[model samples]
Target chain A: MFLFMKQHEFVPQVPYGTRDFLPREASQKRAVEGALAQLFANWGYDEVVTPTIEYLETMTVGVGNDLDQHMFKFFDKNNRILALRPDMTTPMARVAATRFKGSPSPMKLFYITNVFRYEQAQAGRQCEFYQAGVEIMGASEPAADAEVIALAVESMLKSGLQKFQIGLGQVDFINGIMEQSELSLVQRQQIKHAMVTRDLVGLGEILVKSGLSQSDQTLLKHIPLLHGREDMLKQAYSMVTNDKSRRALDNLANIYHLLENYGVSQYVDFDLGIIRDFEYYTGMVFEGYTPGLGFPICGGGRYDTMLNSFGMNCGATGFALGIERVLLALERQGIDGTQNCKGIYIGWNKENLVKAIKQADTLRDSGCSVELAVIPESCAQAKESQKSKGYEKLVYVE
Target chain B: MTSSDMDYLTIALPKGKLFAPSAEMLAKVGCTAEDLSENSRKLVITNEKEKLHFIITKTADLPTYIEYGAADIGIIGKDVLLEEEKDLYELLDLRFGLCRMMVAVPEALKREKLSDYAHMRVATKYPRIAESYFHSMGIQMEFIKLNGSIELAPMVGLAEIIVDLVETGRTLKANNLLEVATIQPVTARFIANRVSFKLKFDRINRITEELRTLLEGVVTL
Candidate 1:
């Protein structure tokens, strides 16, 4: 009983909100990531890998204190705080500002790596997750934003997703309204908090208490409902007379036109309420969604101000797709893209071990995944092994 | 699968006081089904013609259904939303099921202010909201989590204070509990899954607009 208790106490377990992807899940993740890497590369983006741990100051500088609670922070040797990166965008921006500072005019980069975030773990969301993303630095034009959005759509397609939409919005659209309004800072923050959570009811209550004119309150309340195609943009244009908001609307239109040229406008829509959770996003923002998933499968936007904090004063835009989310969406849609079948299972009789080894190597050389049996086996056993192990064929060496 | 199944919109309705009004509100938007009542034995009711699906759920679990996309939309109370804190789109205030979350103490305590007692035993069904409220006020207390009949806690000496929802103050009066502070007003809210709000924008938006118009008329009155 004492020995049993000791054994039970020593039983291994993974940390909470983390998972070990066994062979099948790992293969599916790899396949989807491989397709995304190829797609990003075809779009003229080079891949970059960054350290998983960074000084807490660097991450906070890029993201903000809002995500500080979510980071897995610990003290390093020198008592300096270190945190597992909660995202790749900040690290990518860090790389751009430091290593790739004088590389080129338009530095296009991509990364497929895991990030850590301490949060409630659920389907498609874990404390540690994988993301495949790309960034384009040194370009401030709408074309760059359009390229990123188009690539995001293609990334979804490449990951075996058939039906999805990108809800595109510009941050300045709301900033313009806030600037034009005479509300105090606290009231503005309350409105923004309500908007970020998509709490229209709370937004309505705040606006009513904000003492703004009835027209302004109505306009503010209608922002969350401002979602549709190009014609909705015209309606939004008529509602806001401020130059900042007008310029934002025009920027969205230009990006939309470019997306149309990319033949991806069919999968895009204007949702002026998409104030993404990231505070660093300066201009256009977007989130990708599929039918069966409750949360966004991918999201990103332009962050012209992030790199500037790192001392590189240039504009940049990028997007990231959740690998697990893509896999979950594919599963829910009954789409299977990962291949896990071995080519052959080779079994050997008493004197044919050498032959079986040679045959396995030959099959592997010809691009077949062959699994050779360790001990001697009969033909029937070899066939049974092949059937049970999901090998396509069986080779018995006698 | 039938074509209706392809575009079916699933709504999760809280099972208690909010059920009847939520069902009625959905009916006004052309989404109705049979036996969708608070006491009905049926858990799921479908309106095939309107391509609408409704699932009756416990008040606390309504947000969970919406958050996981098990149901596209849900009608839930703000008090439960505060405690559960699920990430969802709070689209509209249905304006029914009015109540307030209050911190109450027994009348015998004679302590009208919440800050009077620096340390006290508190009981609540909404531990998160209760803890956060106390923390915000710089109060220190031990919490005892109870599911129902929170009013009986203070009377039985299990706790000195209780945090609960007061719809009419009649229950508190019956239990000899006096309200010390009001946390926030509570109401039935219409919420939706983030992805569902975008993918089914047209249908959901139409229903929301219809409901908004109806509620606006009521407000004006």
Candidate 2:
């Protein structure tokens, strides 16, 4: 029985939490990537590439412990710990600090790359995912952050995303206020975890356990509650008393107004509770979302200190959009992405085989997508099954 | 709030302790989940006048529905929210279903402080929360995942301590257990699908604002 079961068992699957994209799906994914690439290029972001596998320390350097745990790691023949790049931002930072040293100020670099993470598989999350992103180095102005965000909004709209938003927040505000408190490291971590998880009740309990002043606790609770239109900024303004916290609010407000100048303020909103990926972002942070999707399709922020950790004293900010997630968002909007390009199918009988080749060549020379397939003495088979798979125009060589 | 338009707002709710109070609040602000509650088997209750729909599901499933876009809005307890950790917007704290997630042990083991039980066995339905809780206490604990009857673990010595939800001391007292630590307070939160909050901003904002207004008097607590 054991031998029979072993013989019948189907082995060598695609492995759990991974995926393979069919041609149509791959084209759709490329379309999203191309749209984002064109926008990044138009905004002066030069495309860049990094190794898919790097030394484990290089990939994990300056990353939060959470990111490290998700990374897929292995050892090289040289006994060096190597890992698949879990994210492009840190690798980009490493490159900008080393390879592009003194290249210029504010180097605008972009990439479309796939990353690997050993994460639990679920809806909209695959172990091997693609990210298209841009990183700006040596830029410190609010406009730089504003530029990346504005481009993100434009790219989403340009890609046919009808409804979406970019939630903007500053890491220094909440962390700054907590830094002033006498709460222990564990207490602060617990509270920050609660904030990022949107757990107000848990945050309240932690604040109480830390024995903060009653007014401080109230202020802490009220800060995360700040959301909605610009008026919510007023509540945030009233709550921030520390100089650093107040300055962070001012930076956020400035970015808000800058996005307004860019005419994309409607796509931008503020959230004080956003502190995810805090190990990387030092100041302004933003996350992109559309209706019906739970996870953010895109997330990035300012990481002025990250490059410095890599031995370069430069300021930087950037954003990355997951290719698969953008497709899902488009699907939610009933945008299947097959509407734009349809292939021309050429069916050849024995009588017109040479003519079919010439006709296919003619169509290809005319900048049309052509799919050639031999018919079984009839064109009926190609005609019926082609429409659903995006073959709009058909040519009968016979 | 009902319109002839095709787009309508869908809300998912957990079908237990928080349901009645949540339904009461929803009724005040243009939705009535009680209509579907009249028939125990009906999962969906609709209000044509308001164009609002409610899907009643297990409390643990509310986040999955919101995450997968089956439901645009949900009202669930903070415990489940923390346990599931789905990516939805916590728009408002409904300020209802007030309870505490506590670390409890049998009264017979109350001789030492919590730190004394380092590397001990702890049981809970929320292993992530329990792990973090014990981690903060500088204790190394083995977590045993139990879906229900968490109190029985400590009573029968399956685990030295249990972390479970408690609204009243009656159950713990009947089982001869003493509450040793409080992790977090539990309350019903109004969560909106991240995408729904954008496309349906006007409607989602109105509902969240109305609910927030409802909690103005009791928010200080």
Candidate 3:
């Protein structure tokens, strides 16, 4: 026999920070997304799909230019730049502002889609990832915020995550503190940046330099540490004297009571320092965390000002759950999220092909998953195929 | 996993100088583990009764462990945190292992300012910190990454300047290098994984409160 070898063996590789989900993972992801989509629909939210790419300026209007570096941008035919949507909320906001502006007062929209960001690849995170999220526009009350927070907890449960907590924070809490302080605008930004990054050392350094009173400095430094149950909220209320800060506390307390009505109060903690990275978040913010993952698996907040950029001038609140993160959390917690059902495999002798096909169709029509073999095989061979393919049962026709 | 195993609090400790003091501090909070010495070959030590696990890791890898939630908490140098840029809660300053990250030059070159040598070759183990510092100062320089013996780079013509941590000026003095600029103060800091900080809040808060009281006592004394 002549040896026939190719000159070069091809090796397949995915692009940096991207991945291909093989069968098992793909099925699990699909199952989770389906569950979330169904749940969102059940909650009275309509599904809205947007284009994968949009004008760079449109994305900047929602997320700001800080995230411009992370976006995947390219030139269009007219030399205008277009970017892969870094987040679905911005695109969802765009759709709401332009398409659904005059339709109604409150438009509840949900999306299950991939968002692109150039980030350092890690477990439970990637450059191109999937997010299942919902946005409620035009409702500015604490109820809207509470509904999204409660829905976020429900989304985690729907994804089969049992142990997780939602850290609820109001940006206005800190904003109120900064408003009352005599520090300059630059100082406020620096302090907020430190708090957002959870850099307590940097925060202390800035507070020391800020000319606020000793008690004010102590109160500002204590904002991040003010996290716990309802009692912590009561304690925080006593710590700040500013009306804005007190109002923020009241907002959190109001949202907490609503969460109790939703029966998700046990899952939330008052994290007064949770100024999310997104500058668009102008109101209450929250992040969902499970034990196994280092990062927040889901996060969102109220951004009442984002729609004004699109000229709609509506208030909005929403949350997004990282699909991969939910799956990873499920795996780590030893919970199987994928319901793989291998119903039956049908095989046949040379003349039994038609019969086998009929049997498969019958089983399928009866709501059982069935796979029919293409070529003829012995009963033993058919059994082997059935066993190897993980089918629960086999039907042999001779 | 046993119910007790589920409650086990894992802590990542850096190897070398900070190891002893870190373990001692943990002991004060009643989280003592066997085989936790720096000289021990075991990477992991456990206190089964107390439900605590201590992982001995390289100084740079400490944050990686905590950030991935492999370890719920860690004690690491601020310099490494600055370089690694991992997302973690800087819980408390441990107030020990103090040092300063300094940009140094060979005495013979006699450069007083970083801008004086605009296009010079700078060597460092911390490329990220050095690059950002240089960029902030609008100075462009080639970088030579060295693992150890950073002072030797400037002495042997490998690089004109070096950026490294200085606990004392003794090493630079022996190597005939002069400190040019101080980047920032370095200290061992207590850090926690973001998820663990919430999930194990009560346990972590107890230890943090204890340590805070201890540190406050030290400060007042």
Candidate 4:
């Protein structure tokens, strides 16, 4: 036996940046997905599934060349390039444009699936992660953006997260402010890079070197810091002179008012410098951050141009919550939970095992969780099994 | 966490050169510590009576700490912030620890124009910044990522030129390199977590105002 073990050694290992979930963790993850799926249904979103593989070029069309290298891609049997999707939004947009033509004006779809990326793994982050999100297509009003946010807030609250806030902003507004600047293309890119990276020092040097007036420099400098109440919008309103800036501010103000009407205002805050995914995102973009988590647990925004790239002209907005990040928040708050089942175990002696099986079927048919166990050799073993298996009740039959 | 941990406003400061000036600025806002640099082994420096705490971390990790809300505030350099690209509020430019990100070459290869090196081989820590800069100019280059001893890359023939931070030009001069172009100027900046800024508005605003006034005073002096 020792010689056989030495000759044919079995090594168990998964790929780096991937994870294997034990029983308890898998159950908890399912619970989180179930809750999100139910909420998506409640909000009039039907479930949809896209193929896990797609043509690499189609998936990489707007996902940026920087992110292209991170996607997991392989060659198909037909010598065609196929890549595992790094996100659901692009595939969903492709489907909405091609498959569902002439069916409905607005299509609401939700997915709970795994997306893979080639990134260094960290706590609450993985190369392969699960996402629960919805896509609302053909709606361009502030109402659509607010509804997406309302659903996100509701989903987070339902998942037992207490301390989380969403930073709301319009990408166009930042673009509008930059358009007002007379800085050359190179200088403007430098300044925008600084602001997006939250580098005040770099931003200031470029603004000063541009030789702008004190007020314009101040406005551009403070754009990243201008986040808060109605007054922040008022402050931004007083600064710009361009029409796009004016319209962007008005759109933001309208979205804010609409979110207030959605009754999720407490979970919403405004920021003028939310530049994440801004190039792909046209109007409203937001990020969800919970206390004590360095990365955003949820992020999405309005992408009017994405579907157009897929041969459709529909406006859409949606957000995806990271399943593992939500679970981390839950675990941090000590909220590891199962599917909330109360089961009764029916135990019987060997002579009456058939009777116990009948009883178990009766209980299960009547909407009760039932676990059946043949009588153990000792009472202690029977009781121990019942306790460990979370049986609410144990019935001993002769 | 202890009761003190719950109530105190936390600030994360970079551990090396930036800590002294950041601690000095925080001191002006009535947040001080007796042992900021006294013990290198310790991570957290605090003044419980003032409800202020500071976490010492690598410059690269400062944005992560602040973004995750582990610390309510952070003071870091523009280079680290740009490299990290975390979501946070840039409250003010504290304006110390200034330096320049420069594209440099060996002094022997100095007089040629940038276009002369059509196939530029560059080595530095800031690959993302360099990639974007070169991509904008339609220039082709090979990039190498190095953590330290970037000055050795050019001498060893690994890269023809290097993009690195130049503080006093002493290191560049010693390494037989000359600065060709400046990418951007960098300085220390005060930053806040976006969520914390809203939840702890009054204290954050008060501290920011105090630091701004103090910094203005320093400039005039």
Candidate 5:
């Protein structure tokens, strides 16, 4: 018998929650990452690399119980507890504080990396996923926030997404409202939860029970309805009583005005109820959504206080685009994925060997991906040879 | 791609008490609902004459169905919309099937501060909702996900607090629980698929306007 004997059962096993990227899938991913990288580079943000793993203690700062619970943790060779970074922003903060210490006042760095989380795999969400994002450090101005939002929209567009929206919210505004309320922490959380979920009734009840003035209660009820075009700012300012809350609203309005100036206003709308999931965010927070993807295609916020957790205090805002989700959106848009895969196939016959080798080498040197054909002559001439060989472009050398 | 002469408008109706009333509302807005009843074994109800279709789905999945273009318009709960955080238009409030999402615990546990249960087990179908709500409190609670009958969680020692939707406090009363807090008010809403809301503007707006009129207090309930 030949070396090729009976094929036993193909071990039907894959590492749970992780996946192998076949050629086409990988090419599609590369296309999305490449476009996003160029978009970030064009915006004068240099790329930075962070490790996939970090100390558990470092990654858990202000991440809260839910995300912290979802992180994958293990012990290192030195018996030190480590975690697969659940998000890039935290790691980026660590890097900025440690390595890039006192590098510059206004540092802008972009990153394309995979974050690991232990969550049930489903549509558009994976255990290990790739993200391409840009962080602008040392700037707390509305312009910096708008730049991040604009970059998010621009990057999504660069990846061929036309139908997407950015919902902007200032955490300070929402958190300010909560802070101003004379209620227990649980009540504040409950109200914030309701507001974010658009549960106006629960919000009303909470506000009513707190013994705040009717006007204050009414203002709180309008949080969910405080969404729409640029003109909504006037309405938002009218709701809050405190300067902090008003300032937060004004900050959002400034960001909106800046985006309008950037010609990207069409893609953004304000939602005061849109609170950031992370506790670190101290300013503007936003999420990018597309119809085709189940989760936000991108999410980022200003974490001015978080860097201080790493012993370096500077205001920063950034956003990360889910590369895999972008690729999926492009696919749904009917954008061709195979066009970039210029795969070539050549026969193994000796007479045609030199010619085939030369052509393959020349093509390879010219930046084309070509693989030598290893199919036997008899297999090539079989009844359904192409079905098994699966070559897209075939070259037969004389 | 060719612009087809025919256009099909799809609506995602949350699969609940609102489904039947929403189907009736859809009919008033010029769509057929002959089989929109929840008792019907149909997954998809279509009206070929009007080029309209309805996809009956889990009440919570209505937003996803609309956002992803699986359905063009969805009648979802304000609760689902609040929790999912998608970028869809809350075009109209159907104003039917109203309720409130509240924080409740065993009546005995009401005396304790909600923060007293910090890092303690809380059970709910809305983990994100519960987590975010608690996070905003500057306290954290561990979430134990349950589909239904969350009242059982407190009784069975699974969780200390139960976050759920309550209509009249009757369910909680029956379960020996008290409303420790309210999160938000809940109502059925008409959510539009972003692209469909734009591309099918005229037709969608017409239907939405009709439904809005009917939903308005102008009509006698």
Candidate 6:
């Protein structure tokens, strides 16, 4: 007998930033994605697909230096460098520019895809995760922008989210501040770094060192403190005398008015300070959040010039919801995205083994989830001739 | 969902201009917070009848608190809401503490024809908001992140433009900077932690509804 010499048996382990979803988790994810897909479709956003891998250059540019460093880069068989998409937006942008160039304007595209980013895994953040979102191309109107925010709210509500908030801000507002400041790039970065880390003393000292006048220092010191609701807009509006600052305020006012008209003002709030992850968004940007999660559930903004890099410039605003984060939120809230599951658990017996198998099939065919006993007769008999497997409504046939 | 068991509704109050006013509002709502205003100490105060507890935190941390369920409700500026982008139900407008986030550039760079610097170096505390604005204008620029002293980035030639929150243009005028754009106007709000809103619906809703009525009166003035 030829005993085929054994090959090396190695312990199984998943690659870092990857996971194997068990049955329960997998089923739950599928159910959540299905509900999200239905919601997206209801908004007339058709699903689209993009490659998970792309040439390094196409995905690298405009992805930002910080993100560029994190991309999982490797070489193909031909030795050409490639990267797993760190975000869906870049891939979607490529698709829009190259493939759907002539298709139409205002293309409402939705996608359920995995994006890879190398970061330390924490509470709601995974190195590799799924995102379900829509990118509305070819429009920059406040109404269209408002539509994205509204759809996000509705999608979350459909995902069984009862309590959440959306923070809206205008990118131009900060740009107006920068346009009026004399701070250097490095100084500006240091200041932002301090503010993001909540270093009030550091922020105060930086303003003083920037050589800003006493009045400028006072005003700059208050930047970290500005935030909250509508009337704050008026306070913010009062600060800017120049037409540029006034225009940015006006843009925010218009958006607020539009959101009010959409009947979503209740769920919406304003934050003039929210600088997002992307380096590309220009006009209005926003993020959605829930209390249970440590990070934003979704985020996007008006990347008007993102397409310009692809040689097509059009005003656009959109947001993306992290499916995994949303799922985690739903779980925390105890709202099952899907509740349908099998109730039948089959018991084993030496004489009834065939019958159990046939019965399991029958139950499954009838749209019931059934678990068949896999143990042999000895173990099965020792436990019980038949066991209900903890089902509240257990059935056994002799 | 009945949530009568969760009695004390925790609140995150951003400490600043909105801090005092929000504390007063909480007092008016019967939520005591004397310890919050005390200096040189970390204190968390709770009011039994009001069924509210207050956590004094950074303006930016208010949303984080609400977002993380650490605080059932929070008081924050509209500007922080715009920047941090947390998901909380803005239950009411506190009608105080207002500001503006703006785009500015050195006076010399201001007239250089924004299009001329295709690759403009921009500095701002609000990078996401700044990037979105320039993106809409079809302008591409490198973002230099600064927490404070955004004005310095322009003066030192690190970036030509700046984006920071502005309450008054006196600073810009003093710095010889010009405003190019305004991202959004700001304010303070009564934001609800999502789960708290759901679990303590009746209590939180009652308090917010009352505060809403009071603010409606203020807004008219």
User: Which candidate number has the best DockQ?
Assistant: 1
Could you give the interface RMSD of candidate 5 in angstroms? 6.8
Rank order (by DockQ, best first): 1, 3, 2, 4, 5, 6
Among all windows of 10 consecutive residues in model 4 chain A, the one with the lowest summed lDDT is A374-383
Of the two candidates 1 and 2, the one with more favorable DockQ, higher being better, is 1
DockQ of all models, two decimals each: 0.58, 0.31, 0.53, 0.30, 0.13, 0.06
The collision pairs in model 1 are: none
Please tell me the TM-score of chain B in candidate 2 relative to the true structure's chain B.
0.92
Instruction: Give the Å error, residue A278, model 5.
Output: 1.5
- Candidate 3 per-residue C-alpha lDDT over A1-398 given as tens digits, one digit per residue, 9 for 90 to 100: 12554457555668988999998899999999999999999999999999999999999998987799999999999999999999999999999988886897798999999999998999888999999999999999999999999999999999998888899999998888888878899999899889878888889889999988999999999888788988998898888889998998899999999999999999999988787888899999999988778889999999999999999888999999999999998888889987666889899999989888888888899999888999999999999999999989899988
iRMSD computed for candidate 3: 3.4
Query: All candidates' lDDT scores?
Result: 0.90, 0.81, 0.90, 0.81, 0.77, 0.74
Worst 10 residues of 3 chain A by lDDT: A1-10
Candidate with more favorable, higher DockQ: 3 or 4: 3
Indicate whether candidate 1 or candidate 6 has the larger lDDT.
1
TM-score of chain B of each: 0.94, 0.92, 0.95, 0.92, 0.90, 0.89
Model 2 gets an lDDT of 0.81
Which residue pairs collide in model 3, if any?
Answer: none
lDDT of 1 at A39: 87
For all candidates, the clash counts are 0, 3, 0, 1, 7, 79
Question: Against the hidden true structure, what lDDT does model 6 obtain?
Answer: 0.74
Q: What is the interface RMSD of each candidate, in Å?
A: 3.5, 5.2, 3.4, 4.4, 6.8, 9.3
Report the lDDT of model 4 for residue B193.
Answer: 80
lDDT of 6 by residue, B1-221 (tens): 11112556787777667777887887776776545673427557666656666678877677877766777777788777767766556655576777788878877776655667568788888777778878888989899888788888888888888888888899999999998767777777777665455445567767876886787777798
How do the predictions measure up, each by TM-score? 0.97, 0.83, 0.96, 0.82, 0.74, 0.63
Isolated chain A TM-score, each model: 0.97, 0.93, 0.96, 0.91, 0.90, 0.86
Query: Scoring model 5 with DockQ, what do you get?
Result: 0.13
lDDT of 2 by residue, A1-398 (tens): 25655765775668878888887788888777888889889888899988999888887676767788888898999999998999999899999999999897889999999998887777678889899888889999998999989988887886778777788888889888888888889888898787776655567667778899998898887666555667877778787678888889889989889999999998888877677654778899988877656678888899888898899998899988888888877776677765565779888777788888899999999999988876534767667646655688888777
